[model samples]
Target: MSILYVLLTTFGVIFLESFLVALGNLRFLFLLNVSLFNKINWKHLLSLSVLSSLILDVIYHYVLGTNLLMVAVPLLIMMGISLAVPLENSLPGYSVKFVCIFLYYLFVAFVPNLILTGQGTVITGVMLGGMVLKAAISVLFCVAFDIVWSRLRKKEEGTKLRSL
Candidate 1:
Protein backbone atom coordinates (compact mmCIF):
# COMPACT_ATOMS: atom_id res chain seq x y z
CA MET A 1 0.00 0.00 0.00
CA SER A 2 2.79 2.39 0.87
CA ILE A 3 4.63 1.52 -2.30
CA LEU A 4 1.48 1.98 -4.32
CA TYR A 5 0.91 5.35 -2.76
CA VAL A 6 4.43 6.43 -3.51
CA LEU A 7 4.18 5.24 -7.11
CA LEU A 8 0.93 7.06 -7.64
CA THR A 9 2.24 10.28 -6.12
CA THR A 10 5.45 10.14 -8.10
CA PHE A 11 3.59 9.48 -11.35
CA GLY A 12 1.17 12.27 -10.64
CA VAL A 13 3.99 14.74 -10.12
CA ILE A 14 5.73 13.62 -13.28
CA PHE A 15 2.53 13.93 -15.29
CA LEU A 16 2.03 17.45 -14.02
CA GLU A 17 5.57 18.33 -14.99
CA SER A 18 5.17 16.88 -18.47
CA PHE A 19 1.95 18.77 -18.95
CA LEU A 20 3.57 22.00 -17.86
CA VAL A 21 6.52 21.46 -20.16
CA ALA A 22 4.24 20.61 -23.05
CA LEU A 23 2.33 23.81 -22.52
CA GLY A 24 5.53 25.78 -23.06
CA ASN A 25 5.15 27.25 -19.62
CA LEU A 26 8.24 25.63 -18.19
CA ARG A 27 11.10 28.00 -17.50
CA PHE A 28 13.75 25.71 -18.86
CA LEU A 29 14.10 25.20 -22.58
CA PHE A 30 16.62 22.44 -22.27
CA LEU A 31 15.18 20.58 -25.24
CA LEU A 32 13.17 22.09 -28.02
CA ASN A 33 10.99 20.46 -30.62
CA VAL A 34 8.39 21.53 -33.13
CA SER A 35 5.73 19.50 -31.39
CA LEU A 36 6.77 20.50 -27.93
CA PHE A 37 3.16 20.56 -26.80
CA ASN A 38 2.12 17.36 -28.52
CA LYS A 39 5.20 15.17 -28.36
CA ILE A 40 5.47 14.63 -24.62
CA ASN A 41 5.99 11.01 -23.58
CA TRP A 42 4.18 10.86 -20.25
CA LYS A 43 4.80 7.21 -19.52
CA HIS A 44 8.54 7.60 -19.87
CA LEU A 45 8.63 10.63 -17.61
CA LEU A 46 6.50 8.95 -14.96
CA SER A 47 8.55 5.80 -14.98
CA LEU A 48 11.78 7.74 -14.68
CA SER A 49 10.45 9.89 -11.86
CA VAL A 50 9.26 6.84 -9.93
CA LEU A 51 12.55 5.04 -10.40
CA SER A 52 14.49 8.11 -9.31
CA SER A 53 12.21 8.58 -6.32
CA LEU A 54 12.80 5.00 -5.26
CA ILE A 55 16.55 5.49 -5.44
CA LEU A 56 16.29 8.67 -3.41
CA ASP A 57 14.14 6.91 -0.82
CA VAL A 58 16.71 4.18 -0.38
CA ILE A 59 19.43 6.75 0.13
CA TYR A 60 17.38 8.68 2.65
CA HIS A 61 16.55 5.59 4.69
CA TYR A 62 20.05 4.12 4.76
CA VAL A 63 21.72 7.42 5.54
CA LEU A 64 19.11 9.42 7.42
CA GLY A 65 17.32 6.55 9.14
CA THR A 66 13.92 7.67 7.88
CA ASN A 67 11.10 5.98 6.07
CA LEU A 68 10.93 6.26 2.26
CA LEU A 69 7.43 7.68 2.09
CA MET A 70 8.28 10.41 4.57
CA VAL A 71 10.92 11.74 2.22
CA ALA A 72 9.42 10.81 -1.16
CA VAL A 73 5.99 12.36 -0.71
CA PRO A 74 7.32 15.81 0.17
CA LEU A 75 10.06 15.61 -2.45
CA LEU A 76 7.53 14.83 -5.17
CA ILE A 77 5.35 17.70 -4.07
CA MET A 78 8.30 20.08 -4.04
CA MET A 79 9.41 19.02 -7.51
CA GLY A 80 5.88 19.43 -8.80
CA ILE A 81 5.67 22.91 -7.37
CA SER A 82 9.03 23.84 -8.82
CA LEU A 83 8.01 22.60 -12.25
CA ALA A 84 4.68 24.41 -12.09
CA VAL A 85 6.30 27.67 -11.15
CA PRO A 86 8.83 28.48 -13.80
CA LEU A 87 11.60 30.95 -13.25
CA GLU A 88 11.81 33.96 -15.59
CA ASN A 89 13.08 32.92 -19.01
CA SER A 90 15.40 30.40 -17.49
CA LEU A 91 16.48 27.76 -19.97
CA PRO A 92 16.50 24.31 -18.47
CA GLY A 93 20.16 23.40 -18.54
CA TYR A 94 22.06 20.91 -16.43
CA SER A 95 22.74 23.58 -13.84
CA VAL A 96 19.11 24.64 -13.64
CA LYS A 97 17.93 21.08 -13.29
CA PHE A 98 20.60 20.43 -10.66
CA VAL A 99 19.59 23.46 -8.63
CA CYS A 100 15.90 22.63 -8.82
CA ILE A 101 16.42 19.05 -7.69
CA PHE A 102 18.81 20.11 -4.98
CA LEU A 103 16.44 22.75 -3.66
CA TYR A 104 13.58 20.27 -3.58
CA TYR A 105 15.52 17.72 -1.58
CA LEU A 106 17.04 20.33 0.69
CA PHE A 107 13.68 21.80 1.56
CA VAL A 108 12.06 18.40 2.01
CA ALA A 109 14.91 17.21 4.21
CA PHE A 110 15.76 20.29 6.25
CA VAL A 111 12.47 22.04 6.95
CA PRO A 112 10.93 18.95 8.48
CA ASN A 113 13.96 18.30 10.61
CA LEU A 114 13.68 21.79 11.98
CA ILE A 115 9.93 21.81 12.43
CA LEU A 116 9.03 18.31 13.57
CA THR A 117 11.93 17.41 15.83
CA GLY A 118 13.19 20.90 16.62
CA GLN A 119 16.67 19.47 16.11
CA GLY A 120 18.25 22.09 13.94
CA THR A 121 21.82 21.02 14.43
CA VAL A 122 23.52 19.94 11.25
CA ILE A 123 24.45 16.24 11.27
CA THR A 124 27.91 16.04 9.77
CA GLY A 125 26.62 18.50 7.17
CA VAL A 126 24.38 15.76 5.87
CA MET A 127 21.68 18.23 5.01
CA LEU A 128 23.89 20.13 2.59
CA GLY A 129 25.87 17.13 1.41
CA GLY A 130 22.75 15.08 0.85
CA MET A 131 21.20 17.77 -1.33
CA VAL A 132 24.17 17.86 -3.67
CA LEU A 133 24.40 14.09 -3.77
CA LYS A 134 20.71 13.59 -4.43
CA ALA A 135 20.60 16.31 -7.06
CA ALA A 136 23.48 14.78 -8.96
CA ILE A 137 21.80 11.41 -8.75
CA SER A 138 18.54 12.84 -10.06
CA VAL A 139 20.19 14.61 -12.95
CA LEU A 140 22.05 11.50 -13.99
CA PHE A 141 18.89 9.46 -13.74
CA CYS A 142 16.96 11.93 -15.83
CA VAL A 143 19.65 12.03 -18.49
CA ALA A 144 19.80 8.29 -18.74
CA PHE A 145 16.03 7.98 -18.88
CA ASP A 146 15.86 10.61 -21.58
CA ILE A 147 18.42 8.77 -23.65
CA VAL A 148 16.62 5.46 -23.32
CA TRP A 149 13.28 7.03 -24.11
CA SER A 150 14.64 8.69 -27.23
CA ARG A 151 16.11 5.44 -28.45
CA LEU A 152 12.89 3.55 -27.85
CA ARG A 153 10.90 6.21 -29.62
CA LYS A 154 13.21 6.12 -32.58
CA LYS A 155 13.00 2.37 -32.79
CA GLU A 156 9.24 2.48 -32.66
CA GLU A 157 9.17 4.99 -35.47
CA GLY A 158 11.51 2.89 -37.55
CA THR A 159 9.38 -0.19 -36.97
CA LYS A 160 6.30 1.65 -38.14
CA LEU A 161 8.13 2.85 -41.23
CA ARG A 162 9.32 -0.62 -42.09
CA SER A 163 5.85 -2.06 -41.65
CA LEU A 164 4.37 0.64 -43.85
Candidate 2:
Protein backbone atom coordinates (compact mmCIF):
# COMPACT_ATOMS: atom_id res chain seq x y z
CA MET A 1 0.00 0.00 0.00
CA SER A 2 1.43 3.34 1.14
CA ILE A 3 5.06 3.28 2.11
CA LEU A 4 4.63 6.39 4.24
CA TYR A 5 1.72 4.82 6.07
CA VAL A 6 3.62 1.62 6.62
CA LEU A 7 6.64 3.60 7.69
CA LEU A 8 4.79 5.55 10.29
CA THR A 9 2.86 2.50 11.42
CA THR A 10 6.01 0.46 11.81
CA PHE A 11 7.77 3.30 13.55
CA GLY A 12 4.92 3.61 16.00
CA VAL A 13 4.93 -0.11 16.53
CA ILE A 14 8.65 -0.01 17.19
CA PHE A 15 8.14 2.43 19.99
CA LEU A 16 5.19 0.60 21.44
CA GLU A 17 6.69 -2.83 21.10
CA SER A 18 9.82 -1.69 22.88
CA PHE A 19 7.72 -0.36 25.73
CA LEU A 20 5.67 -3.53 25.91
CA VAL A 21 8.77 -5.66 25.83
CA ALA A 22 10.15 -3.57 28.63
CA LEU A 23 7.07 -4.45 30.64
CA GLY A 24 7.30 -8.07 29.67
CA ASN A 25 10.96 -8.20 30.49
CA LEU A 26 10.20 -6.87 33.91
CA ARG A 27 7.89 -9.82 34.25
CA PHE A 28 9.38 -12.27 36.77
CA LEU A 29 6.53 -14.68 37.23
CA PHE A 30 5.58 -17.58 34.99
CA LEU A 31 9.29 -18.26 35.02
CA LEU A 32 8.62 -21.97 34.79
CA ASN A 33 6.57 -21.99 31.61
CA VAL A 34 8.76 -19.90 29.34
CA SER A 35 7.68 -21.93 26.35
CA LEU A 36 4.08 -20.69 26.53
CA PHE A 37 5.07 -17.13 27.36
CA ASN A 38 3.55 -15.71 24.21
CA LYS A 39 0.83 -18.22 23.48
CA ILE A 40 -0.71 -17.83 26.91
CA ASN A 41 -1.07 -14.05 26.79
CA TRP A 42 -0.53 -13.37 23.15
CA LYS A 43 -3.93 -11.71 22.87
CA HIS A 44 -3.36 -9.46 25.84
CA LEU A 45 0.13 -8.60 24.68
CA LEU A 46 -1.02 -7.88 21.15
CA SER A 47 -3.84 -5.57 22.22
CA LEU A 48 -1.84 -3.73 24.80
CA SER A 49 1.14 -3.46 22.49
CA VAL A 50 -0.98 -1.95 19.70
CA LEU A 51 -2.71 0.49 21.99
CA SER A 52 0.49 1.69 23.60
CA SER A 53 2.24 2.08 20.28
CA LEU A 54 -0.70 3.90 18.67
CA ILE A 55 -0.91 6.30 21.56
CA LEU A 56 2.81 7.04 21.38
CA ASP A 57 2.60 7.40 17.61
CA VAL A 58 0.03 10.13 18.12
CA ILE A 59 2.67 11.93 20.14
CA TYR A 60 6.07 12.47 18.51
CA HIS A 61 7.49 10.19 15.86
CA TYR A 62 11.13 9.24 15.65
CA VAL A 63 12.78 8.86 12.25
CA LEU A 64 13.98 5.32 12.72
CA GLY A 65 14.08 4.42 9.02
CA THR A 66 15.01 0.79 8.29
CA ASN A 67 15.90 0.35 11.92
CA LEU A 68 12.20 -0.23 12.31
CA LEU A 69 12.86 -3.77 11.18
CA MET A 70 14.35 -4.31 14.60
CA VAL A 71 10.87 -3.91 16.03
CA ALA A 72 8.94 -7.13 15.53
CA VAL A 73 11.20 -9.20 13.35
CA PRO A 74 13.58 -10.44 16.03
CA LEU A 75 10.69 -11.11 18.38
CA LEU A 76 9.10 -13.37 15.79
CA ILE A 77 12.43 -15.06 15.31
CA MET A 78 12.87 -15.53 19.05
CA MET A 79 9.35 -16.90 19.30
CA GLY A 80 10.16 -19.35 16.58
CA ILE A 81 13.35 -20.30 18.35
CA SER A 82 11.48 -20.78 21.62
CA LEU A 83 8.85 -22.90 19.91
CA ALA A 84 11.31 -25.06 18.05
CA VAL A 85 13.69 -25.54 20.96
CA PRO A 86 11.10 -25.67 23.71
CA LEU A 87 12.82 -24.67 26.94
CA GLU A 88 11.17 -26.70 29.66
CA ASN A 89 11.46 -25.67 33.29
CA SER A 90 12.52 -29.23 33.81
CA LEU A 91 15.21 -28.12 31.40
CA PRO A 92 16.25 -24.45 31.02
CA GLY A 93 14.66 -21.53 29.14
CA TYR A 94 15.05 -18.19 30.86
CA SER A 95 18.70 -17.78 29.86
CA VAL A 96 17.72 -18.43 26.25
CA LYS A 97 15.45 -15.38 26.31
CA PHE A 98 18.12 -13.37 28.08
CA VAL A 99 20.65 -14.18 25.39
CA CYS A 100 18.15 -13.44 22.64
CA ILE A 101 17.30 -10.05 24.11
CA PHE A 102 20.98 -9.24 24.57
CA LEU A 103 21.74 -10.13 20.99
CA TYR A 104 18.72 -8.15 19.80
CA TYR A 105 20.00 -5.01 21.48
CA LEU A 106 23.49 -5.64 20.18
CA PHE A 107 22.05 -5.77 16.68
CA VAL A 108 20.12 -2.61 17.31
CA ALA A 109 23.32 -0.81 18.20
CA PHE A 110 25.49 -1.88 15.25
CA VAL A 111 23.50 -3.73 12.59
CA PRO A 112 20.89 -1.07 11.76
CA ASN A 113 23.45 1.67 11.42
CA LEU A 114 25.58 -0.49 9.19
CA ILE A 115 22.66 -1.68 7.05
CA LEU A 116 20.92 1.67 6.65
CA THR A 117 24.06 3.78 6.10
CA GLY A 118 26.11 1.17 4.31
CA GLN A 119 28.99 1.90 6.64
CA GLY A 120 31.02 -1.23 7.22
CA THR A 121 31.50 -2.18 10.82
CA VAL A 122 34.80 -2.46 12.68
CA ILE A 123 34.55 -4.98 15.46
CA THR A 124 37.11 -4.33 18.16
CA GLY A 125 37.74 -5.61 21.63
CA VAL A 126 36.68 -2.26 23.07
CA MET A 127 33.43 -2.25 21.13
CA LEU A 128 32.64 -5.79 22.19
CA GLY A 129 33.51 -4.87 25.74
CA GLY A 130 31.13 -1.91 25.63
CA MET A 131 28.33 -4.05 24.27
CA VAL A 132 28.89 -6.56 27.03
CA LEU A 133 28.81 -3.78 29.60
CA LYS A 134 25.51 -2.46 28.31
CA ALA A 135 24.03 -5.92 28.11
CA ALA A 136 25.08 -6.63 31.66
CA ILE A 137 23.42 -3.39 32.78
CA SER A 138 20.22 -4.49 31.08
CA VAL A 139 20.43 -7.84 32.85
CA LEU A 140 20.73 -6.03 36.14
CA PHE A 141 17.64 -3.97 35.46
CA CYS A 142 15.65 -6.98 34.29
CA VAL A 143 16.67 -9.04 37.27
CA ALA A 144 15.76 -6.21 39.64
CA PHE A 145 12.38 -5.85 37.95
CA ASP A 146 11.81 -9.59 38.10
CA ILE A 147 12.60 -9.72 41.78
CA VAL A 148 10.13 -6.97 42.58
CA TRP A 149 7.41 -8.52 40.45
CA SER A 150 8.02 -11.96 41.89
CA ARG A 151 7.69 -10.72 45.45
CA LEU A 152 4.54 -8.82 44.61
CA ARG A 153 3.03 -11.84 42.88
CA LYS A 154 3.83 -14.11 45.78
CA LYS A 155 2.29 -11.64 48.21
CA GLU A 156 -0.86 -11.43 46.13
CA GLU A 157 -1.09 -15.19 45.88
CA GLY A 158 -0.66 -15.51 49.58
CA THR A 159 -3.52 -13.08 50.21
CA LYS A 160 -5.74 -14.94 47.78
CA LEU A 161 -5.09 -18.25 49.51
CA ARG A 162 -5.86 -16.68 52.90
CA SER A 163 -9.15 -15.38 51.57
CA LEU A 164 -10.12 -18.83 50.37
Candidate 3:
Protein backbone atom coordinates (compact mmCIF):
# COMPACT_ATOMS: atom_id res chain seq x y z
CA MET A 1 0.00 0.00 0.00
CA SER A 2 2.91 2.32 0.45
CA ILE A 3 4.07 4.46 -2.43
CA LEU A 4 7.53 2.97 -2.11
CA TYR A 5 6.13 -0.52 -2.53
CA VAL A 6 4.06 0.52 -5.50
CA LEU A 7 7.03 2.07 -7.26
CA LEU A 8 9.24 -0.88 -6.44
CA THR A 9 6.70 -3.30 -7.82
CA THR A 10 6.43 -1.28 -11.00
CA PHE A 11 10.20 -1.25 -11.39
CA GLY A 12 10.31 -4.94 -10.60
CA VAL A 13 7.98 -5.59 -13.48
CA ILE A 14 10.17 -3.45 -15.70
CA PHE A 15 13.22 -5.37 -14.59
CA LEU A 16 11.49 -8.64 -15.29
CA GLU A 17 10.54 -7.55 -18.78
CA SER A 18 13.91 -6.06 -19.55
CA PHE A 19 16.31 -8.56 -18.03
CA LEU A 20 14.58 -11.94 -17.81
CA VAL A 21 14.15 -13.73 -21.09
CA ALA A 22 11.75 -16.46 -20.04
CA LEU A 23 9.49 -14.22 -17.96
CA GLY A 24 9.85 -11.05 -19.98
CA ASN A 25 6.45 -11.17 -21.60
CA LEU A 26 4.68 -11.75 -18.31
CA ARG A 27 4.92 -8.11 -17.25
CA PHE A 28 1.37 -7.55 -18.41
CA LEU A 29 0.08 -10.17 -16.02
CA PHE A 30 2.22 -8.90 -13.16
CA LEU A 31 1.17 -5.29 -13.59
CA LEU A 32 -2.48 -6.24 -13.85
CA ASN A 33 -2.21 -8.28 -10.68
CA VAL A 34 -0.74 -5.38 -8.77
CA SER A 35 -3.10 -2.78 -10.13
CA LEU A 36 -6.35 -4.64 -9.70
CA PHE A 37 -5.84 -5.92 -6.16
CA ASN A 38 -4.03 -3.12 -4.35
CA LYS A 39 -5.06 -0.64 -1.66
CA ILE A 40 -3.54 2.32 -3.44
CA ASN A 41 -5.75 5.24 -4.33
CA TRP A 42 -6.88 5.45 -7.93
CA LYS A 43 -5.14 8.79 -8.43
CA HIS A 44 -1.84 7.44 -7.17
CA LEU A 45 -2.28 4.32 -9.22
CA LEU A 46 -3.01 6.34 -12.35
CA SER A 47 0.03 8.52 -11.88
CA LEU A 48 2.26 5.58 -11.15
CA SER A 49 0.89 3.69 -14.12
CA VAL A 50 1.65 6.60 -16.41
CA LEU A 51 5.12 7.01 -14.97
CA SER A 52 5.85 3.32 -15.45
CA SER A 53 4.58 3.43 -19.01
CA LEU A 54 6.87 6.38 -19.73
CA ILE A 55 9.86 4.55 -18.35
CA LEU A 56 8.93 1.48 -20.35
CA ASP A 57 8.47 3.49 -23.53
CA VAL A 58 11.92 4.98 -23.24
CA ILE A 59 13.52 1.65 -22.42
CA TYR A 60 11.84 -0.05 -25.36
CA HIS A 61 12.53 2.79 -27.80
CA TYR A 62 8.84 3.22 -28.38
CA VAL A 63 7.35 6.07 -30.38
CA LEU A 64 7.11 9.23 -28.28
CA GLY A 65 3.37 9.88 -28.38
CA THR A 66 2.02 6.37 -28.55
CA ASN A 67 2.80 5.33 -25.00
CA LEU A 68 0.90 8.21 -23.45
CA LEU A 69 -2.08 7.44 -25.60
CA MET A 70 -1.83 3.78 -24.75
CA VAL A 71 -1.74 4.57 -21.04
CA ALA A 72 -4.55 7.12 -21.07
CA VAL A 73 -7.13 5.40 -23.21
CA PRO A 74 -7.47 2.25 -21.16
CA LEU A 75 -7.31 4.14 -17.87
CA LEU A 76 -10.05 6.48 -18.97
CA ILE A 77 -12.19 3.56 -20.01
CA MET A 78 -11.58 1.92 -16.65
CA MET A 79 -12.47 5.13 -14.87
CA GLY A 80 -15.72 5.37 -16.78
CA ILE A 81 -16.57 1.78 -16.03
CA SER A 82 -15.78 2.25 -12.35
CA LEU A 83 -18.31 5.08 -12.20
CA ALA A 84 -20.99 2.87 -13.68
CA VAL A 85 -20.13 -0.12 -11.51
CA PRO A 86 -18.70 0.52 -8.06
CA LEU A 87 -15.75 -1.66 -7.11
CA GLU A 88 -16.85 -3.62 -4.03
CA ASN A 89 -14.85 -6.31 -2.28
CA SER A 90 -16.92 -9.30 -3.32
CA LEU A 91 -16.78 -11.99 -5.97
CA PRO A 92 -18.85 -10.14 -8.55
CA GLY A 93 -16.92 -6.97 -7.84
CA TYR A 94 -13.65 -8.83 -8.29
CA SER A 95 -14.95 -10.18 -11.56
CA VAL A 96 -15.72 -6.69 -12.82
CA LYS A 97 -12.37 -5.35 -11.72
CA PHE A 98 -10.59 -8.26 -13.35
CA VAL A 99 -12.47 -7.76 -16.59
CA CYS A 100 -11.64 -4.07 -16.65
CA ILE A 101 -7.99 -4.67 -15.85
CA PHE A 102 -7.85 -7.52 -18.37
CA LEU A 103 -9.11 -5.27 -21.12
CA TYR A 104 -6.78 -2.50 -19.96
CA TYR A 105 -3.73 -4.74 -20.13
CA LEU A 106 -4.71 -6.12 -23.50
CA PHE A 107 -5.03 -2.67 -25.01
CA VAL A 108 -1.87 -1.35 -23.38
CA ALA A 109 0.17 -4.38 -24.39
CA PHE A 110 -1.14 -4.85 -27.92
CA VAL A 111 -2.50 -1.68 -29.50
CA PRO A 112 0.45 0.68 -29.17
CA ASN A 113 2.91 -1.85 -30.51
CA LEU A 114 0.73 -2.42 -33.51
CA ILE A 115 0.56 1.28 -34.25
CA LEU A 116 4.24 1.88 -33.59
CA THR A 117 5.27 -0.88 -35.96
CA GLY A 118 2.77 0.19 -38.61
CA GLN A 119 1.07 -3.15 -38.43
CA GLY A 120 -2.39 -2.88 -39.91
CA THR A 121 -5.35 -3.28 -37.63
CA VAL A 122 -5.80 -6.98 -38.03
CA ILE A 123 -6.00 -9.45 -35.15
CA THR A 124 -4.44 -12.66 -36.39
CA GLY A 125 -5.02 -16.14 -34.98
CA VAL A 126 -1.69 -16.21 -33.19
CA MET A 127 -2.29 -12.84 -31.61
CA LEU A 128 -5.70 -13.89 -30.40
CA GLY A 129 -4.26 -17.08 -28.95
CA GLY A 130 -1.58 -15.14 -27.17
CA MET A 131 -4.19 -12.81 -25.71
CA VAL A 132 -6.20 -15.69 -24.35
CA LEU A 133 -3.16 -17.31 -22.81
CA LYS A 134 -2.13 -14.03 -21.23
CA ALA A 135 -5.60 -13.61 -19.78
CA ALA A 136 -5.57 -17.11 -18.30
CA ILE A 137 -2.17 -16.56 -16.72
CA SER A 138 -3.20 -13.19 -15.35
CA VAL A 139 -6.36 -14.62 -13.85
CA LEU A 140 -4.49 -17.47 -12.23
CA PHE A 141 -1.87 -15.24 -10.67
CA CYS A 142 -4.34 -12.59 -9.52
CA VAL A 143 -6.49 -15.17 -7.80
CA ALA A 144 -3.48 -16.67 -6.09
CA PHE A 145 -2.31 -13.28 -4.90
CA ASP A 146 -5.77 -12.46 -3.58
CA ILE A 147 -5.89 -15.65 -1.59
CA VAL A 148 -2.43 -15.23 -0.10
CA TRP A 149 -2.96 -11.60 0.80
CA SER A 150 -6.35 -12.30 2.36
CA ARG A 151 -4.88 -14.99 4.59
CA LEU A 152 -1.99 -12.77 5.56
CA ARG A 153 -4.40 -9.97 6.44
CA LYS A 154 -6.49 -12.31 8.55
CA LYS A 155 -3.43 -13.52 10.44
CA GLU A 156 -2.33 -9.97 11.07
CA GLU A 157 -5.78 -9.09 12.35
CA GLY A 158 -5.79 -12.13 14.59
CA THR A 159 -2.57 -11.02 16.20
CA LYS A 160 -4.05 -7.60 16.82
CA LEU A 161 -7.15 -9.15 18.42
CA ARG A 162 -5.05 -11.25 20.80
CA SER A 163 -2.94 -8.22 21.82
CA LEU A 164 -6.06 -6.20 22.66
Candidate order by lDDT, decreasing, is 3, 2, 1
Global lDDT of each model?
A: 0.46, 0.47, 0.59
lDDT of the structure predicted as candidate 2: 0.47
TM-score for all predictions?
0.38, 0.49, 0.64
lDDT for each residue of candidate 2 in 1-164, tens digit (9 for 90 to 100):
34454456455555544564476432111111222244324544444344433444344242343333443555566677777676433123445555655565566556655765777567678766665655555555555554554555444352222233
Count steric clashes of candidate 2.
0
Residue 72 in model 1: shift from native, Å? 12
Clash count for candidate 3 is: 0
Compare candidates 1 and 2 on TM-score and give the better one: 2
Residue lDDT tens for model 1, 50-129: 45445444533433323233344444543565576542223454455566556555555555466557776454575578
How many Å off is the CA of 83 in candidate 2? 3.2
Question: Where is the poorest 10-residue window by lDDT in model 1?
Answer: 27-36
lDDT of 3 by residue, 17-128 (tens): 5653256355452345344433435666666666666777787678665555665665566567667776444565556655655565566556777877766466667765
Q: Which ranges of candidate 1 are over 4 A from the true structure?
A: 1-92, 113-124, 154-164
Best by lDDT: 3
